[model samples]
Target: MPTAPAAEPVPSVPSPLIRAFPTAPPPDGLPAERESTAPAATGPASPGGDAARTAAPAVEDDADAARRAARAPGRREQRYQETRARIVDAAADLFADRGFDAVSVVEIAKRAGVVEKTVFNHFPMKEGLVFDADPPMREALLDAVRKRPSGESVSAAAGSFVVAAVGLLGAPEAAEGVARMARVIRGSRTLQVREREILGELTDSLAGLIAEETRAWPGQVEPWLAAHAVLGLYASLLELARDRVLAGVTGPELSGELRRQGRRGLALLQFGLAGYAKRR
Candidate 1:
């Protein structure tokens, strides 16, 4: 009983909670420390944000201005072309109805519903209108001569083109139109001169093409002579069709006659002229 009453002093137990240490106080006059170190919040008025927002609008405005400037010239050129085409079409119809000399520039302008000045701006003169309308035919012939198949003789290429031209003349509508055009041309000395000049140009162009294809000198007599012969045959066929149409020929009658003439003419070219040209 005396031993139990003398129980040993109870030992003190340590607590499980960790002890907290106080951080050093901020410097004098400084604000209290924040829990998070993230950047401060900003409004639209902030310097860098304002600069980035302003830069985008300026760049977009500049790009839009450049695009408008680029399309302006193309729109202008398209309008000019449309106006020029109207003037040419009017001139062609007028010339067909009344010979080239018979129609005045003012008349053409009036028919086209445009000012005379506009016509002059495109053509410079009335003859240019007719020449422009008929350019495709001459261009086709020239291209055929220039781009003849490799290893094929120039005479063969020229002969083939001539046959094609004659076939075009045989078309009833073309035959009638050509008859009208021929009459107009014959009626005016000015147009006659222009026609001769155009034909001469065509001949010279063909001669040059032949020279290039054959590797001959441009001024050589042979190429020029061949060009003249080929063009002359084509001219004769054109004249034949025009004369028949003017003589009241039409339909199958005109077509059949033109076909016969074309066969005979082409046969002569194939046998006689082509052989002679090849030898040269």
Candidate 2:
């Protein structure tokens, strides 16, 4: 017994349950300080405590896995969106080259370098391909009015939204697209009907938003009236753009014309047209 070695101290591991879900004081009105200062039990852990300790690490691992999975559009979603865009572009080019009715879904799929089934998967109908942007446009328009700045009228917000959109017609590339779209619509009765349907749908949605914002009574017609008037002004602007595009007006001149017309339209809406155009 000449050299006796001292025992090494063992490090204590914290309970997994305590790390995951800290214990709270019992409902018997025990103080948190008393609970915190309580001595550890020397006896075996209760069944519930053992189960919670066993599950804590698994629960934590699952949460971490979920967080990693929640990141934006991985490779699969990116590929899907890219394919959809290609299909839409191919369909548009083909439709513009030869009228909408003349272009087949098969041809569109071929041009996009995808199978016909893929085209059908993206766009259920030919008309759907033509109006691919409708859903997003509708959402954006409604959002513009819904989120307008304080003190701004809904009509003003909507008018501004439409006017801002006219800038798209002024893009150098947009001139050709606008002209082609106008020609395509003129050549196809189906497209004309579709355009009107889209407009009507827009009007109905805007009217509903107006009603909600104004808290209109059950039978009130004011929201519908306001929606119609605002959208009518928008329709007029669209016609103006179509006419200008067909006439080969684009770039600064096209933008200038649209801005002037849009301002005039907004002005007319703000200040009633009761005084102007009367016999002087």
* Top model number, TM-score: 1
**Residue 103 in candidate 2, Cα distance off native in Å:** 1.6
- My TM-score estimates for the predictions, one after another, are 0.68, 0.67
Runs of candidate 2 with Cα error greater than 4 angstroms are: 1-73, 273-280
The TM-score of predicted model 2 comes to: 0.67
Report, for every candidate in turn, its global Cα lDDT versus the true structure: 0.61, 0.65
Q: Write the per-residue lDDT of candidate 2 for residues 180-279, one digit (tens) a residue.
A: 7777777889877887888888899998988888778877887787677777877787778878989888888987787777767776665652222122
Model 2 per-residue lDDT at 121: 89
Residue-pair clash count for candidate 1: 0
**Model 2 Cα shift for residue 79 (angstroms):** 2.0
lDDT per residue (tens digit) for residues 92-160 in model 1? 678777778889999989987899998888888677775542444566676665665555455556656
Model 2 clash tally? 0
